[model samples]
Target chain A: MKEFETVTVFDLLIRYIKDGRIRLDRTRFEGLATYHDPCNYGRRAQKRFGHGFFEEPRWILDQCLENWVDLHPCRENQICCGGGGGALTSGYNEERIYYGRRKMEQIHASGARMMVVPCHSCHGQFNNIKAKYGLPDLSVKYLWELVADCLVWP
Target chain B: MTPENSLRISIENLERTRCAQWPHAQDNCLTCAMCSGACPVAGVDDFDPRKIVRLISMGMTDAAADSRWPWICTMCGKCEQICPMGIEIPDIIRRLRAMRARDKVPGILQDGLANALRTGNNLGLPKEDFVFILEDVAAEIAEEPGFEEFTVPIDKEGAALLTTIHNKLVNTHTDDLKHWWKIFHAAGEDWTVASDNWEGTSWGYFTGDDEAMRVMAGRIVENMRRLKIKTLLWPE
Candidate 1:
């Protein structure tokens, strides 16, 4: 276990950008964007892994998009997208959407048309709520999707 | 007193579960409701993080374990994060979830976890289909002007990075795989994906089965050893 290091995609993206292995096209993505902190990567990681990924995603977003905002109570205090803990596949559809009320409110309040999430669970939940809550204007993208879209080839 | 107004608590229930793993003891909670306030699903099915702690501390461990609240909770750790007493609400909830029999676990989660244990992926997608999807997706990416001749290097040894795919990306969202592949190609990073036991999400963690969680995670380590991969990019 000690021979190999386990890192997240965020770390890889950061390293690639820093080393100039990849350059981002900032103009690729438009519209007001905001981030949703996945609890495991944020609060839980802080307690268990000793270092939370609070700033990594934001730093990557900074390079990819020109306009982005932070969700209220981001990082440690961010609200759950309510699709976590395997709830997306837990067969609690109505209750899951109900649980995401606060998250819906947060996105509405942030006025961000695009919400970038780093976790699959959060991405699934945000997509579910965005449709269930009738927020067609809002679209969800994975952090990697943003990076991929903004990649400047050659 | 009416039966509805009065209830009995059993110390034996609490004592049995007292030694279970939780970072902090339930006795430390002050019923401050901070956890409840921070919890997004606090009121769902009459569940709240504070109530779970209170029930466990009051010798109502059975009541706490039997309720649907733990399952309802997303285990997002917001309650634990905001707890003034620093009680591990998520840990306690996970323990509560573990108390139930495996058959009693919610259906979708239970079935998915079982499939993951039996097969390499949660959806139990066959290796042939997995490879077929990868090659097909790569073909699509290659069709794009810049990514001609792109191919997925499966189970290649001595690669610098090994990435695990989220099952959904292969099952329903095959196109999404291109996003990361594009980056890897552009950066010229040496990465390979395992052709077997390559699941990214650990359903055992969600279902509160520690042993299963260990087995699932062990497969990843085994992959690293077999493939001689130096780094893992786990996006799950």
Candidate 2:
């Protein structure tokens, strides 16, 4: 719930930024951002009123930056970091690393310093995946958390 | 073997279960530890995913079935993703949860799961009430300054895709409800939340009872059929 709200909050905030009605100093980010789709959310999003997920946090990032950047291998088919489905609990520790190594490669490929995750499961999974697999350092935060942090504080 | 011996064998087999053996296990295959490392609950303090499976294989279910760790496992299958032996640890954890749900419900979590089975939602919230709350939430979203005309679909047939959210997403995290709502609008996509069977979180899957899981799946399928939605994008 907190996870989804992160996205929602991001959306609302972005809308406020672009609303053009609320005047403020706008400084768009000149960096790339990537989104990670959690399977649980994917499991439920497959057929709700004939829709598919594409621009998750990407959409919000787009609202904030013209160069939101591109993650070569985007959502849906994105590699599993081997942490969800109770896998992070320890039944297959060594195997989790083996599988997560693939995801580590992807984040390395993205070359983005920041990865936006809107799902709680994905947040924990990525952090653990990077540490476990020794992937290159990259900042990770909930999509909303990022937006929340960049509120252009008054 | 004599007939008496055969009878003894029959009784032992009858009493045999996944929980009946534990003391005999010396250690696990080094590769099998992947299951434990991949498990989400491993970091949750003493809840070793591999240990749970070891207990299951050894038939040490009494302690496992009673452990609160079963409820904590999200059944995400990361262990299976990395398992070299191809062991379906998530399935094992699911079965354990189901077996335990029968003996005990744990707390409001089980109650919510039961309510979902009985009333099509974790809270057993009435359909009318659910619809009312959904509209109310959406209304609030619309009134939030720039969200004046935000539209969240409800039973809109022939939508290209169906986006899903956990009931907990809307009921508890109302603000979060707008995350996807805003996504849908930004994409210029067509979607709707089902008036019936819209709850996407499958607690039945967690409970380990296949019957309940199927029931939950059946509801979602039926809802899809009703809405004529072809794809389901689940947001757990």
Candidate whose DockQ is highest: 1
Interface root mean square deviation of every model, in Å?
1.1, 9.8
Candidate 1: TM-score of chain A is: 0.96
lDDT per residue for candidate 2 within A25-119, as digits (tens), equals 22545566666666545432433324335555566665444544555444544455555654443344555555566566777777666777766
Give TM per candidate: 0.95, 0.57
In each prediction, how many residue pairs overlap at the backbone (N, C-alpha, C within less than 3 A)? 0, 70
Tens-digit per-residue lDDT, B36-69, candidate 1: 8888887778888888888777656667777788
Worst 10 residues of 1 chain B by lDDT: B1-10
DockQ (model 2, Cα): 0.11
RMSD of each: 2.4, 10.4
